[model samples]
Target: MNVEHGVHDAPYFVPSPSRWPIVGAVALFFFALGAALTVNKVAAGWYSLAGGLAILFWMLFGWFGDVIRESQQQQYGQQVDWSLRWGMSWFIFSEVMFFAAFFGALFYARSIAIPELGGDTLTRQLLWPDSQAAWPGNSAPTSTSYTPMGALGIPAINTAILLTSGATLTWAHWGLVRGRRLQLICGLVATIYLAALFLALQAYEYHHGFLDLNLTLASGAYGATFYLLTGFHGLHVFVGTLMLCVMLARASQGHFSEKQHFGFEAAAWYWHFVDVVWLLLFVVVYWL
Candidate 1:
């Protein structure tokens, strides 16, 4: 290796300062303000929220477009690639902690809070005489009437759908590794379809819960936990689907090669994390 060439490659690539960060901060300010106002029933909150979401999307597309162009131009060296992997790993870890907090809430509601409330004679006699230490119906301070979602129907089907998507994504990765463009594209298409189907089923399930079963966020602890877990997971699935769609577009354009495909791998990691969260939700929120 030439000494000068080696020295030149040693320095990592640094992108020039951009306006996207400030734009993102402004978007987040709108989001925060919008959320606060909306929670208090302010009318303008809707417009603010919409504007914030639009700005956020614009920032994401612009920033990601820049990165994609840089990657395509081969500006990202192995150092950048390794740093990206680490960044993605930390991102997934943060997501894990985020879900963990929700799960902790569920566990606390079920195992600790409900039981302590029901089991204490003085507390129950004075506060919630009718309350019982139950999983679904009477778990709250007052009796709540709503059908609890079960694991038998849509939940089970969604489980299988998400698991299958994981498999298809893996197959796509294998195809990319083997330099089979057709196989990769087909696998990604299948995965995207599966993900979309899962989202559709979940939406229908939510509709059924609200309309026919009278289940909602107002239905007390069960409803709150159910929607919080499943709704957030659905959002994750939606995001993962979008990421896969982008990957599919790039793959169609012959972007990723056999050796360099961290973008696809990052998306795959996130999708698998979503799948695992759904599995836990199925067992805990629906079945158990």
Candidate 2:
């Protein structure tokens, strides 16, 4: 049984012991600690956060490098492929649940908390006599006066950009499946450019919100929910763009074939997930 080579006769390829898992755990610990400290206004927290990010990136590069090498050596079998598929599926599902939790919070704030507080006569009289049961109420203690963000302008453009990126990503997938390397690379480049543009425009919109509209985290529930949803989605878009960049590099290196390209497919799945989430956010957060 040649474990290193992952002999075809073996039931499953089991890798030897590695330090990456513990390293990753340590990195996460620092990340969490740094985040907590930073939130409390500790200056040293920046250094800790930067260090943690460096360690995390190092672990990712090393760990993924090993997996890629193993894959290129044909160490993975059909069972391993299926395992990877299931693993990616579950990861995406967990992400879905994460976003669902935030959306649930938004629902609770809008449907139950706000209405109960404002609609009840005694509760309103005792608690917040000046507050109204509005969707974007300016009644919180820390609330700042601001104009609500609309569905037009940069948001509309960003929506189109994300939708177009999704199309370009699908085109890349088609090229990969057809064994058209040039087409695949071109499509990936277009998708990456679009993704970057979307992020840039989002950043600009955030700036506009904070500077011109006075929309901020302190601007009551509307601002909080707006940033929470859109901010996280933007992070996902940045991550997806990085993933697409990795796929582009792999494709350029002649890594994937017409049949075996789970890495590319995994990135595509993530990008599409980001796109769908943005659509939901556009409707729930901006339009309606």
Give the 10-residue window scoring lowest on summed lDDT in candidate 1. Answer: 1-10
TM-score of each: 0.93, 0.93
> For all the candidates, what are their Cα RMSDs to the real structure?
2.8, 2.5
List, residue by residue over 147-234, the lDDT tens digit for candidate 2: 9899999898999999999999899899999989998999999999999999999999999999999999988878888999999999
Per-candidate local distance difference test: 0.90, 0.90
Q: Extract clashing residue pairs from model 1.
A: none
Tens digit per residue, CA lDDT, model 1, 45-148 = 98899999999999999999999998998888877888899999999999999999999999999998778667867877877877778877756654358889
